[model samples]
Target chain A: MENIHLENIDFEYAPGRRIFSGAAVDINQGELVLLCGKTGSGKSTLLRLIQKELDTKAGFVMQNPDNQIVCDRVYSELEFGATNATQGNERHRLELIRQRVAETAGYFGISRQINRDTHTLSGGEKQILNIASAMAANPKVLLMDEPTSMLDPIMADRVIDLVKNINRELGITVIIAEHRSDRIFAYADKILLIEDETVVCKDKRSMAEYMSRSQELRGFLPEIARSVEMSPPPLSLAEAVFGKAHAVYVGKEAPLSSHPVLRLKNVSFAYDRSKGALIDNLNLSVDGGSITALLGENGCGKSTLALLSAGALKPYSGSVKINGRKIKKAGENSAMLFQDVTLHFTGDTVDGKYNGMHPYDLSGGERQLAALDIILSKNPSLLILDEPTKGLDYNEKEKLGKRLEKLRDEGKAILLITHDVEFAAMFSDRMLLMFGGKIVCDRPAREFCESNIFYTTAGARLSKMNSD
Target chain B: MRRFENFNPATLLIYYMTVIIPIMVFMNPFIILTALAAGLVRAGIYERKIPVKRILFSAVLTAVMALVNGLLSHQGDTELFFINDRAVTLEAIRYGAVNGLMLAAAIVWFSAFSRTLTGEKIMALLWHLPKLALLISMIMRLIPRYLERYNKTGLAARINEERGQVPEKKHIMQITSAVFTWALENSMDTADSMIMRGYTSGGKRISGIQFRPGDAAVLALTAALQTMYFLPETWHGILMAVLCFLPEIYRIKENVKWKIYTLKI
Candidate 1:
């Protein structure tokens, strides 16, 4: 029997403001299921409900991971969950527990030889340790909510692969709710579409279904999904262009450049000299109306560049100008979609009319939409979005793309810093790929994705040549 | 909320002030109960900002924490009852209960008032104050929102770290840096947004918020509650409870209308 079931369930944050209504799904024992939805659609809340952690359940990774780890060192944190698991029975096999712990550590890339001191590890490493600790107890049902939204592509894949392995090996019933469908679709056996706080669609759908559908039958479509949905439902760019397709650039005077809206000249930034520069002498110029995507490997200087552009962090050297005015007030011009949607708000009130403060409190796609609201209010000449789609689902990415496109068309230059190559490739007019803190390459995002810098499940197959 | 045409903010200030400072400096339950009853009645009549779930949660949690602490910690002479060899002293336990209820009441009242004090209202009232102060106030006002977003990102980063997505090579250093950089950037973005909204243009500041007679009445009542502390302990307790309990009742009551705070958008 399933532990949780949603039978024609309808839930909304407010009455008549339906988030997910008519949501019906069943979670059988030991079943790995994926719940996908737009940011405001309530996938996370659903996971919480299923885990019976509505207030304290599934979604939260304990907001204060820094202080949450009470244990001093790394090994203790790793085995903390296992120790909790074996709280009483002295007879239960110590050897088996050790073996399990070691195996789990190996899977998560924890070294037995490493010191247990948590203070020694990096924040990402600490987070990895924290997550592994949670899995220590081996909760029969695991709810990973947008689990990899913050990771670089390679790291996200590693996590996805680990999750897939867990489902395959341990038979741990997994409920993974993620906004980005790039890594999740390949492993998901079933897709639960949550719309307006309701599960509207459930299917044993293939990535192909998502790949081929248009206008998002369930919710918002990823650009890959949208590009595929065009007549005959072309699956990739080549198909959209060459497979019964005419040049989209047909009958258009290619966009003319206005005055460079944001100019960065030989800008380089380094946290510490020994560590080297995150952005090394990067020169960039943006036309007044354009969608610019700054992409890089995880830990690369993409976000650093966003901070640089927004003037959040002073560059080690070089100059950044906004609208030909030297960048000032870093926090204002960069209405960044922080990888975590929760960090944007500055108040205690969860929901209200929120006044002008609402955008600052938005999460993921909602935050992106809120940024738009603030931008409209402020009439900013340039908008810098950092990791805009970090935790957004299929639909959210689509809405953001369309909105950013609209903003771009309206003459507001927008820079998107992201690790999701497909999002960069699909929505951006131009994409700049960063490697080891420098702009390794810059081209039209689609053209860039056509090269080796891209390789996600969607990226690999959703290319123009593949569709053709 | 939108349908209520005339909302009162003065009562909110008084209520918040009263919640923070006890209605009376005296220790008496009867007076507190009376004050609570009065607040309920007043709320029933005026129909101010509807108390939301968060306010209720804070009140309940405060009440529980207080009660639990009272039950566990206080050991004294007067015996009300005994549980597990420990005597529940009447005065000591009562002391805990009262403090707890006071806390709960305070949260409810303050939350209701807090909800009423919107950015628009503050801007309208303090527009004559230094423009920078008003702007600082707005930025400061968004502190809670930003804190929540920041915590959320940190936690999400935590989860990602566990999943093997956060690079194994760099550890948590980048996440912290990312979080810090992002927070700093958001403030700048908000500032930019404010500037973009023509905040720097020095346009004649226009405020849509207006005060009403009802608002004045709320203020008077709040001021009276605050003044009750000058009276005997009994009066203070009653006044405090009355002021504090209204928001709790408002939160529970549905489909009721009080003049909602309105601004011409």
Candidate 2:
């Protein structure tokens, strides 16, 4: 059964500024579709078009989990859609709505937070609530735009798993647009590629093959699919084990510098006096001419450590020294770039090229680079970035990686806090995993990734399984 | 307390009105004292601890109001003292004290009312007016989100200032403008989400609270007790006390019933 059919759909933001032209897609019932494109490539616009085309009820979940939520409390948000759909305030109808809310909450494992304030939930929990609320209406189709783009790896995986479960178990058609396709690609029954005012829909295997042939779109493929050299490339790590292992390049370790750029000596910090220290006696050093990646779970002190090293936060006991000089204030010797790049902008124009344009007018990747430019103007020897790859596409990440490498070559120590293992492996010279308020593992990026089990990238895991 | 909170929002709304309206309308000293006592006890029970700071603040505020009124108005017969060549009479002081006590009682009752009728309950009560209820809900959700954005933007602006960018006093204006732009942009997405979820379907809202027989009983009792204010001053105070402490009495009854039931088990 055809759940959604879009034929020769035309869309444009303004005259001659077209997003999609002669674009068509046919999605069947119970099928999970993946939408992939570059930043500002009309992924969200395409999802909105699909929503508009559907005559039946369709649930829509967008990025930025905070905005989509309309109710103050979790239970209210869950039943918001159903209450808005039902015609009257009849007792039986209200009871049915309550039952649907309860069932959706239980299915999504959000029953524990059923009474919590929607604003109090974490980004991941908020996104889950959005999904549950959308599902509460009992819609025939669900459309999510970059659902996991703002989440950590664990939370992102949990959301993707729930999405997959909703598609498989509930028999509802799911169409999701995501930049982080590595986690969701394998479960997609059909892949929709949007580029240059056109939409190409193909089955998963054919999409993999098609992506492999297109150099620009190849980055959209899963790491396992990209690593395997097969007729129809394997979509998952388990299937890639049967294929031949590709030769992986591990970069040579850089020589340690005697004078480190950013040094944290026995740092211990806690936000609350009653609670344990978030960063307890943690020591780390990032040398000039090297990029260091700090990997950890959300709230495991990666960002706190970055702030400490940047002098934005003071440790309780230890000293943070930039170039062997103790720093007393934030942005004194180190430049820190926050996750939201918009925070870094104070005016309309960042530079001559982006003159007369609002900072928000720029794309996500460009805004990040522009923020980096503003921060770099300080000429600080140490640069600290928190979640730099949060909402960027592959191309943007690549651009950011090259820019970081250039900064490293200029003898600026770069400290990157990210959950993207793939970006860390591909760019950072050193990898440090923080757990339990301490750095548990510190080594060269490739060596560190190759040795770890769960923390490693899909390519590393695939190679490890093949070698096994 | 939980059982009291579980009553239908309509019943709770009516209960609050009946309990508060009489105290507001009748400025009798006995009625004021009874309402104040009940409000303190209810607030204490709901919060799990006596709000000593709130009590102290209210006491200081009432004393200041009484002192100001007594000093400014010297129309009474019995003069306690002369302040700025004007007599401060005992009758004037008493009148001021009563007015202050009335204001204080109203504050306490309203505080208790706010604590009992949370945002959810308020929305539930306003379900008959779906648009207003939704607007209230959206405001409750967005105000916090907007403040968060403002704080984040302020922090970012400070970060920029630390990096050799000397923003003037207009920094606040800059932050506000940025946040406004961000809100406007994100509101589009929120509106799209609302449209997708059938927000334009003109359907009535249905709150999750169920109106049971116990709620009806409480509503009837509240109505009956509130009407006793028309009887006499003494009866008004007595009935008002009963109406105000209804939740506490019900809680004790339920506790005793549970104890006996558990003993039988």
Candidate 3:
């Protein structure tokens, strides 16, 4: 049965700025659907329209998890929806709401944190709590807008797995709009591609075939499908055809100068004196004209090391040298771009057409580029970026990768602290893994990805499987 | 686990009212002293340690108030000394000290009350006024988030100022404006989330607290002891002591029972 049906619906922010005109789509019950598009391409508008149509029967989860939360306590947030839906303060009705909240909390494996304050939860935990609260309403349809765009890979995987379980076990329909489709492509039953004020819905194989033919939308294809040249492209690593597990060259290694641009010797740092050091006696150096990537799990001190290198944070017992001279303050000889690029703008406007508009009004990718432009104007020898690709689409990531490459050609040393393994493998010359305040693995990007099973890309995994 | 925190919000409210009302009504020295002692003990039990800071603050405030009152009011028979030709008497000092003690007892009781009645419990008590309760809850949740964002924006402003992109004098104003804009923008999403969840103004709120038999027993015991306030002064003082330390006595009993059961095992 068709769970959601939108026929000839038109939506627009203003009179002339039409978002979707005569957009029609049908979603079947119990099917997992993936929505793909560029930022500001009406993916969220479509979800909101469907929600407007479905009214109280549909649950909507937005990108920013912090904004969706309405209650201070976790248990109160869990029952917020049911309480709103219930009419009178009858004993039986409130009891049913409590029971539903308890059951939903158990299903989401969030019972341990049921009584916690909402603000104290981690980003991933907050998103999970949002989903659980949405489910507590027992809606027939769920509409999620880029739910994992702000999460790390591990947390994103957990959320995706939970969504799959919800679709299979309880038979609730899910339509999720996302930027990164590599992890969820295998599980999506149908693919809905929104472009040019129109919506096209296709099955997995047909969507892959169609996306492979289009140049602009081709980046949205899964890595396994994009890498192998075959008819009716595969949706997963298991079904992909691989010839050999050859180590493909990621990029030309930049010639190392005699003196590295940034160096950290025996650096140790801790935000608090009572807790142990977050970065303990770590040593690292990045030469000029090289793009280095630092990869780690959430809260593994990757960002602290980045700050230490950028001279934003001082180590207690070690020296941070830029161009063989110890630096004393932040932005002395290096520039750093924070993960939330919107924070970089303190003015009402940015350069060019973004003038007269607030920085928060721009899209994610545009805001990032504007921040990078400001950082580059300082002419620093070393550049440090923390999670530059967060909340950016595939096209924007490609643009950023090309921009970083251009900077590397100009003899600028770039250090990226990120959770994007695929982008790291595709762009960086060297990949380093940080664990427990130490560099556990450091190698060329190709070798680093090929040797590790869990940290490798979908294409590398497919090739490895074929070789095995 | 906090044992007192598990009681129903209504029971906790009544417990605090019965304990505090008598302290405000009666000016008897015996009643005030017992209430102070019981308030200190109860606050200690809730905090798991002596609230030395609160006690010290109260002591200093009480001493200063007593001194001021004793010197200003010259209505006593037994004059101890003359301060600037104004007599300071023993009876006046005693009266001032009793008033200070009464204020100190009230302070200690209120502190203990605040520690027990957390935001959630207060919301539970205000469930009948759903709109006010939700507004308070959202404010409590969003203020910390806003403060965090403000700090982040300040750090970003500092970074920009270091790069010479932002002027030093204008940065704070810029950050304040930026955060204000960000809050206004994000509030739209918050509103959408509320609408998506089918929220209405007059909807019923569920506090998720169950009124168990233990809650009823505590309420009944508090009501029985509250009647002693109308009795003789001595009886009222003793009963008030018991009333104020009821939660501490319950906590001790539970701890002893668990210790004995574990030993038997």
Candidate 4:
């Protein structure tokens, strides 16, 4: 039976700017529906229409968790929906609400943070709290509008797992609108493609069949699925439609250099003096004309190390040196690009309003490029980027990779701290793996991909699987 | 560190309002002194230590206010000397001192109030008035969020090369303008998110903390103290002074009891 059904729905942002017209959608029980489209293509609007918090028994999670959390504390945020559902006599219902909050938080592995301030939670934890709050409402269907769009790779994967678990355990139908199809496409049962105010719904089999017929839509396929060729692409290498994996290209690594552009010696840092250092006694150097990728789990001090290396943060002990001289001020010899691109825009540019529009109104990829351009205008000897490929599409990621390569060829030292293993594999000359505020391994990018199994790229994984 | 941080916010509101109203009404020298001393103690407790710098700044401010009042208003009987052909009388100085003390006491009490009454506490206390509670919460979030965005905007202005030849003042002005604009625009998203989460959906917001027995006791005590204002001027003034110092007296009694217990052991 269809849990959610919409017939001939018309949605328009303004009189002339029509988004959806005569769109019809039907979602069945226990189905994992995937909503795929370009940005501003009305995916979120459709989800909102379906959820309609006032009328339907549907839970909607927005893109940015920071804006979604309605309460101050974690426990209160989780209870927000349930409290809104209560009719009368809060004293009697609060006990049940508390129990529900505790149970939901425990299910999402956020029970320890129940008493913590919601605003104080990390980005990943905030997204988890958002999902937990939605589930506490006891909705029949859960609709998430790009829930993982603002999260790092680690957090993004965790959110997907939670969605999968909720569907499997509770038998609740789930619909997710996501741009990162590479991360979410595997678990989907049906695919809904929205474009130009039209919605086309299809099962996985028919969707793959359609992809086989159209090359334009093939770009929407996951990277792992694209590694092999067949009538319908495979979700995993183990279940490939093709006979074997294609040959994966590996980039050549640059030679090591003695003269370094930026150097860190015995650097240590701690947010609180009493809790001990988060990054302890780390020493490293980035040679000019090379791309160095720093890889680590979220909250493993990758960003802190990036900031320290960029001279934005001074170490408690030791020093940061640029061109073998002690750094005087931040941004004098370095420029750091943070994960959030919106925080880096100047709101206006010299050239006729920066692409003829405001920075905030631009697309995610455009905003990122604008931010990069702004940073590059400083023309620092060293470029330190923290998760630069966070919200970029495949084409945008390629453009950024080319830009970084050009910078490297210009003898500019680049420190790329990212969760994008594939992008790093394509561009980086060297790779450094950090665990618990310390570098555990440093190797050439090629060797690094060939050595590791889990953290390796999808192309490398497919190659290994085929070779076996 | 605030002694009343986690107490029922309604109780804190009643307690502070009840204490401050009488101090404003009586305006007597003795009553003002008691209120000032109590205000300082409350601020100290909330800060978890003696805020020496703040106290010194308040003293300087009090002196300035007293000096201004003494020079501006010459309504005293006993004239001491003349300053620029104006009578600088002893009675005028004393009256200015009383006014200054009242202003300083109010400032200190408010400082403590701001420290203790966080956004969460205000929301809990004003659940019945949802719009007002939401406005207070939004303002509380706005200040920190604005500061953070302002700092980031400054960094962005530099990266954009907008600050290359501009002076520091111009750079600061540009960054401030950008931050204010962004904050205004971002508020729309915040409002939408709140609405999507079922805010203002004609339902009662169930606060986590309910009114407990101790909260009721606090409310009763504040109510009884408020009634003392109707008593005779001298008698009521003395009661007001004692009420102001009640927290300090309790703390002293508790500390002495603890010290004696330690000595016996």
Question: lDDT per model, in order?
Answer: 0.57, 0.82, 0.83, 0.75
Could you give candidate 3's per-residue lDDT for residues A241-351 as a string of tens digits?
Answer: 443333333323433443489999999999988989889889999878988999988888998898788776889888999999998777778888998887787667887
RMSD of 4: 5.4
lDDT of 2 by residue, A1-468 (tens): 447787897888999998877866788999999999888889888888778767337889988888899888898887887776565448888788878888888888999998898899999999999998898888889999989888887888899999999999989999999887777888898899887888889888888888888778878988766555655677776666665655354333554454588888899999998989999998888899989998988889888888778777789998889999998777777888888887777666778567767787898889999999987876889988989999888889999999999998889899999998888888988899999899999998878878999887777776677677
| Docking class of predicted structure 4 | acceptable
Clash-forming residue pairs, model 2: none
**lDDT comparison, 2 vs 4, better candidate:** 2
Candidate 1, residue B65: lDDT: 60
lDDT of 2 at B159: 49
Interface RMSD, every prediction, one decimal place: 23.0, 1.8, 1.6, 2.9
Clashing pairs in 4: none
Candidate 4's residue-wise lDDT over A1-468, tens digit each? Answer: 337776788877889888877756677899899987766778878887876733436777877877777666776677776666555576877777777887888788998897787667888888888888878877778888888878888788888888889987888888998767775677788899886678888887677667656655665677776556655677666666255657345444654674699998898899988988899898888989999999998778998887777666789999899888887666767888888777665446424336467787777777777777777876888888889888666666777899899989999999999988888988899988898778887888877877788777877777776667
Q: Least lDDT summed over 10 consecutive residues: which range in candidate 1 chain B?
A: B192-201
Q: Model 3 TM-score?
A: 0.93
The TM-scores, one per candidate, come to: 0.53, 0.93, 0.93, 0.79
Would you give me the overall lDDT of model 4? 0.75
Predicted candidate 3 versus true structure: per-residue lDDT over B127-166, tens digit per residue: 8787898899899899899999999887655544464655
The candidate that wins on DockQ is 3
| DockQ scores of the candidates | 0.01, 0.56, 0.65, 0.24
Model 2 interface root-mean-square deviation:
1.8
TM-score of chain B of each: 0.51, 0.89, 0.88, 0.73
Q: What is the lDDT of residue A299 in candidate 1?
A: 74
Which window of 10 residues has the lowest lDDT sum in candidate 2 chain A?
A247-256
Query: How much lDDT does candidate 3 score?
Result: 0.83
DockQ of 1: 0.01
